[model samples]
Target: MQTGISYCFLLGWLLCSCSETKSNHNQSIQDTAAVLLQQDSTSVFTTTALVEDTTVRFDMSEVPSEPDTKIKILEIGNFHNNEVWKGADNKQWYGLFQTTTGYYVKKTIVQVKTVYDALLDTKYVWSGKQVSVSDKDTCLLLITGISLPERNIDTVVMSQKTIWPSEKISFTVDSITYTLRATGKRQKISNEVSDYRLYISIIKDGVEKQQLLVVHDVFDDTMTVVMWVGDLDGDYKPDAIIDVSNHYNNHRPALFLSGEASEKEIMKKVAEFSQLGC
Candidate 1:
């Protein structure tokens, strides 16, 4: 009877030990699954945070999708009656002209398209050569090619009177008065050649601001003349047309548009005028 009792006790002990081990294994598995689920949740949260940060850093609406449509104004002028000094090689060299009262200033308004076309225009070619000069005497050695002629101003009526470099030219655009004045300082190019530059000032609401307008460099004997300033596009804006000529020859007119219209709009107007052969 004792032996049978001992056998029953051993069997019960084995069964209890097996059950406890199985319970511990199931608890371990549950803990591992919980840890994996927490890691996955953390990964998803981190990804979401990164996306939100990127969205906050960049705003798509702030970037422009189109080209610049603002109006661009370019002024053209000439430097004339420049004195030529002979070099040691007996070749004539041009001296930098330094006079505010003897040059010409012209303003031209063009669109981005016109500028592109002008850059690609093959009619006018610019070439220059450097002349050898002695160290004692400073002279300009580079000489550019002639200015290309425009058909529109070839027969247009020009001013018979001479416009001095110091003359203050004024025009009204959109009821705002703009005055152009030449500073008379020589615009130096590499300390050899120089041209005349003009300043455009406007008074709006009793505030005045001066802007620089660069014109052509005048190397030949020429005269400054104001061609015309009026409305050309019926946009109620005053358009200024100026030119530099030599004894009724080599007439070059520069057209300027000053108004509320954008550069793109001005380019369209120029294109239309070109189609009309004007």
Candidate 2:
């Protein structure tokens, strides 16, 4: 929870050169999984481990972590500079400074489980070292980690799919029923472009558990895709990472971890990464 550790990020944490750029609309489920590895003695990225293919076949259950890996980074989030000091509850964080000089300085990293069989989204909290980096320009950090899985888990992931209005898909996990539904309306926003509003939600036993997404006034041609589906927090309940971007010219993906949800909610959105296309 210190303010000086970005080393916890997976080997290749994608640093943005500029904000709001075009994003990959067709990214696969594997792209959402961040595999964090531990560096060996006296070096950076000097370790290697064996990993199995995780293309996510329908017959697959759980994805395997590389044997030599350290913490399996689920999702890293930014709470803006002002929100860094307060932090989120029941969550962990690894912080780093985005210095005025436009570079990163490594500080601290806490070791978690070496092997991860499940992927979960997380919230965060930064501890100290706010002044260690200089006057500062940006505040950033990572999220929760647990020692090891209590038991082996089966694969509960589904491939990415574009969901249209009136189109719903159902699947079973942990003996619980789940349905992904999409509903929306279209309106003209401009002479050349139309506006749209889409409501994406989860249904269980004739009840709507949560309104996962409600994209409003999105540009024409925008579509929502259920990027990946499964238990993102290993809570046995379903969690998701979804793309509710304006498909033709934008990419806005959000990560939801079931473990962070409130009692009445099925999942809580802990992180969202976005970009805009010209």
Candidate 3:
């Protein structure tokens, strides 16, 4: 009888210990859950606060004109994998680099009002030279900057617009009296190639200045086209001198003279004139 009683007591003690162990394990799980919930709540609140502050700051920064205005290019830099720009979507391209002013500056091949803002917290790698085509066809700019691995990426593509002016002039084919006039603001042509478009002023008596035939005979790809008003051949009258050379060649310096002078005098005087750099 004593042995049976001792066995019963031991079984009861074992059951009690197991129950306590299970309760302790459950409590530990609950404690961990509470800590995780608290951390999540704090994180959410902090993010919300940051978002609200950023919205307000953006509104405050709105102004008529940007304080630090710059020009943006549609296309810049060389391309990786030797792939060229396919000209699918005509977006301006820009390449940002650290400038001497501590702020980043960009050089664009396209003509734009200002440079696009540099990306924040993004590190651009200039491991290889990349080439980009400007959105504007008149200005073919080549930029040397960071390379992007993907195409049509919002972070890589620019939204800025590039404006280009025409470098082609309309001249008459007849050698009659006429007046030259500038139609609009002169636009910048590609600096890589020196070819500018200028309106000619033809002043003829008893002749409709607009009706006279003006033919443009000098359009050079390698020469710099320049215009000046001066007197030629000891004549006190003002004559137009369009120097068609880059001051390097000595033979047949192309000249365009518009006045009452004969074609022979235009050729002789211009050939004798010295060359000047553009």
Candidate 4:
């Protein structure tokens, strides 16, 4: 027949060119598995939006307690290692940092655990270290949540308390007395023209509350002091941690919390952290 119909039309065009090259090699492996599943769902939606944009929370009725256990999570920073936190979950947490050098020393109780970061999924921090910290000698000041009758009050008040201006420093703690007074007016700063400010007042029971703290233009002795007082949010009352940094090579701590104070306010700074020395 014409050479067998040209060999069956060349074997039906070589079986339709091997079925269109095996359907383009299975559509290039399904378009490379749909671009690797859209890049693994955009890398898990950008690590769940970087763990919800660096969480910070802390407002569960501002620590009213006993709903599912308190401490709404604080975790400010400087504890190091990628710093991302939230899971205190089992409760009971606190770091505080800074182990020595001025304002009466002592505050290194860091064990830490609760990590699971596939990009910060669960966190609390610093575990497995049987205590041997040295960020060239520690500094961090917060991590939050601790109450239960505890009172190390940074070595239970060792020393450093010279906040004068009109002079009036006092402290009683558990029985509650805290008096503090340091009005202002101690100038120097050639041309920034200053009032400099300082304000303190505090009083309690008889109620006085003023609190401005410091403004500084610099010069003359420069030391705000008062470093530590008891009951940091356990709510037994009196809580403090001022450094105000009139400068001793700069420290600036500032943290007061009488359980978020407010009958009209006696103490309520909540938090502050700063440190620098070269």
Candidate 5:
């Protein structure tokens, strides 16, 4: 809720650079998890504890007081002379800055959570940053950012047209909880409105990128789900897998699209809930 932090000219350039230059536009950006680590005298990562669900942990105080690492904002543009300020809810703080292409300063709120790694079976807190995009003219813009851990790149950036379904939604195949909020509307295929939720999780492996998405549909009453494991990030080779559901109670098969090696694998049950019936 603070104002006059700096001149708005800087925001103008960020927009033009992303639009005017096609090559400059980063389309593969996705959501990921991050961890804010501080180097102690022992030169190791020691967790910075704060209040429960408090954004104060990420306060700019840590930014200026300690050695700041270059944390990337997936599915969003990089910041310029950005400063983190505490939100009205003193419990948290946000990264604020003027964009080169806009008249308003961007505000990014973030949180951290530790999740169990299925592969390693260990717990790791993933940083999640939410960015709200606004302009002087538009009082309410739908654009927001979610920063995932480096391993999980490719953040999602969408307007109100694509607010993901949070109910029954999840990031991983085994997740019992939903990560996004969804409307009850069904897609007719003709409509750009997607009732399904797409989750892309990536981890950096040397120079190559590993991308995986848990795209599923839970709108229908039937048991329908799709699991895709491939390079949805478009890195030339096809390294993904897709699974479509096959329902029992008179439901149709679903479609699960994945990989680029050849045919797009379609899940039988997934088709059951497809827009074909909607």
Candidate 6:
């Protein structure tokens, strides 16, 4: 019986040792798996960091910067004929005569009434000539003078005092439609009369922003502003065309480049009237 008890005890101890060895093996396998998982996570993190660095170091030097602001000044002349006329009855009349020296002389005629045998005859007498003058000349003559219709100074002054209506302008850039309102304001330049300033308002993406553009009048009565969209710089992006004219005779073209910030900036003055290939 003692021998049988010893064998049973030995068998029980052997079984317990086997269970402990199995548990140790399982624990070792679990630790190895955990280590492998940590290695894999570290490798993934390193690979992700390298990919981020490569993305951040991408080259962007080829993209062009903002172009320079080009300013062009143009001088406009008058559009009119110059000549003088003398009637067969010795009466003088003002006419337009084209000459190489470019001078326009306006002659005045005086009328005298005489009665002969209950008949009244009116005779025209030629007076001295008066030449057109400029602001710089105390007395001068203009060769290419434009004669506008005589305007009443009082009426013009009254009209100037009245409020002018705003003009609506629209253009498309890159398939996006843009609308602007030109509000008129008077601005005085140096040694010149008060000019009309077109304060522009831009509407984009359902938001309204002001002062996106402004056009200064070169002449008080003959100034005009025109806007359109075109690819002026050959960049394929739609550039804005701001054309200022004086009675459609002198054209000043300005270009606003297209980019991310173009909607909020002003245009650059480009070509004068003479530079246009018309």
1 or 5: which has the higher lDDT? Answer: 1
Query: Which candidate has the highest TM-score of all?
Result: 2
Ranking by lDDT: 4, 2, 1, 6, 3, 5
* Candidate 4 wrong stretches, greater than 4 Å: 1-93, 96-181, 188-231, 252-276
Each prediction's Cα lDDT score? 0.39, 0.44, 0.33, 0.51, 0.28, 0.38
Model 3 alpha-carbon drift over 4 Å, by segment: 1-199, 209-227, 234-236, 246-260, 263-269, 272-278
Runs in model 6 lying further than 4 Å from the true structure = 1-165, 185-195, 199-201, 234-237, 245-250, 259-263, 270-278
Please, what are the lDDT tens digits per residue for candidate 4 over residues 96-210? 4444543222323443343232332334322210122223344334434444343344324534475555556565666655566655554355322224555544555776666
Model 2, 66-142: lDDT tens per residue? 22222222223321222222222223433333444432323334322212112222122222112222223353323
Clash counts per candidate, in order, are 3, 5, 27, 0, 55, 7
Clash-forming residue pairs, model 4: none
Residue 138 of model 5 has an lDDT of 32
lDDT of 3 by residue, 1-278 (tens): 99999999999999999999999999999999999999999999988784322221111121122112122122233222112222312333443332233222233443222122232111221222233333332222222222222221111111221111243232332343322332223325643322333344343455333321122333333433333232321233333333434334321122332344463232222211221221
Where model 5 places Cα greater than 4 Å from the true spot, the runs are 1-88, 97-208, 213-215, 219-278
Best model number under lDDT: 4
Ranking by TM-score: 2, 1, 6, 4, 3, 5
Model 5: per-residue lDDT, tens digit, 156-267?
2222323334443223322211233334445456333334544432222333222223344443333223222222223322222222232233322222222222232211
Candidate 6, residues 1-278, lDDT tens digits: the string is 99999999999999999999999999999999999999999998988783322221212223223222233211223211111112211333222222343322243232222111112111322222212222221212111112212211110001121122254555555555555554454344532323445544445688765554445554544444444444433343444445554333444544344432354553433433222212
Q: How far off is residue 78 in model 1, in Å?
A: 24
Per-residue lDDT tens digits for candidate 1, residues 89-189, read 23122221112232122222211111111222233321111123222222211111112122121121223433345656666666777676663433345
RMSD of each: 21.9, 34.6, 20.8, 17.7, 35.6, 32.1
User: Which of 4 and 5 is the better model by lDDT?
Assistant: 4
Q: Tell me model 3's lDDT, rounded to 2 decimals.
A: 0.33
Candidate 2 local Cα displacement, residue 112, angstroms: 21
